[model samples]
Target: MHKIEELKIWKKSIKLTMLVYQLITALPSNEKYGLISQIKRSSVSIPSNIAEGAGRNSNKEFKHFLSIANGSAYELHTQLILTIELGLISKEKVQPVLDLITEVQKMNYSFQKSLETKISILNTQS
Candidate 1:
């Protein structure tokens, strides 16, 4: 993509972050700083890292950033599960968020693989 903001992955990540923010708003007052903070940070990291990585000059660096973004995505996914288990959110309430996360994860994986291929070609060229 010419611009990080133009990438579908980035757009999806933004949507996912917004969804998480909405979900956390409904959390108990006590968790406003605990689970709430953690979830928001992790969710935001997904898109933020993607944009940061896309700004890098090298494909390798971009791939590294994408990897970090993927890691953050998994972290958010884990937290969502924890939220369900802790009774902080019902399975129904969390389902839409989970679906969005899954979609973003799949897109990230596809983009990562594409980056890997491009990087391999670039390495060969050099």
Candidate 2:
């Protein structure tokens, strides 16, 4: 089985999750169950899905989970934009996390493509 912790995308997603939590703390208490909750869940899903996918036995399964994680990344990205628009946090404070999310998205996309290639090769050989 692959080591999820060793994956660069996993590590970066973890970092993004951490930054999201930190940033959320500064938001108003009224948002505790609103944008705050949604943001936190989506942020956490990115890494959690990656780890879960890594534990799967097949490349196809892993790739499927990566797609889910990618979706969560986009969801989080949208929520982050909403937070900025709502004035929950300053752009400067959230920029680093946004940047990290973009990096994770790119890495996830590349990794998924690599897995697809591997799967295609296996299919051809069979």
Candidate 3:
């Protein structure tokens, strides 16, 4: 199995999750059950999925989890944009987190593609 902690994408996702937590603190308390919860959940999902995927036995399973993580990253991106549009947080403050999410998303995509190629090669050999 691969080491989840050794993955750069997982590390970045953890950092992004922490940053999201910090950002949400500035949001109004009424949103605690709304945007705050949504953002937090999506942010955490990225790394959680990556770690879970890495623990799996097959590359296909790993790729599936990575795809899920990528989806969460996109979900987080949308929530962040909604938060800014609602004036819950300023674009200036949210931009960095958004950028990090984007980076993680790209990394996840590349990683998934690499896994697909590896799987294809393995299948061909078999």
Best candidate, TM-score: 3
Q: Which ten residues in a row have the lowest lDDT in candidate 3?
A: 1-10
Model 1 CA deviation exceeding 4 Å by range: none
Determine which window of 10 residues in candidate 1 has minimal summed lDDT: 1-10
Ranking by lDDT: 3, 2, 1
Collision count for each candidate, in order: 0, 0, 0
Checking candidate 2 for backbone clashes, the offending pairs are none
CA lDDT of each prediction against the hidden true structure: 0.90, 0.93, 0.95
Candidate 3's displacement at residue 60, Å, is: 0.4
1-126, model 3: which lDDT tens digit per residue?
Answer: 799879999999999999999999999999999989999899999999999999999999999999999999999999999999998889999999999998998999999999999999999999
- At residue 67, candidate 1 shows an lDDT of 90
Top lDDT hit = 3
Q: What are the per-residue Cα lDDT tens digits for candidate 1 across 1-126?
A: 349878999999999999999898878989988888999999999999999998998878888888999999899999999999999889898989999989998998998899899988988998
Stretches off by above 4 angstroms in model 2 are none
- Candidate 3 off by > 4 Å: none
Candidate 2 lDDT tens digits, 38-66: 99999999999999999999999999999
lDDT assessment of candidate 1: 0.90
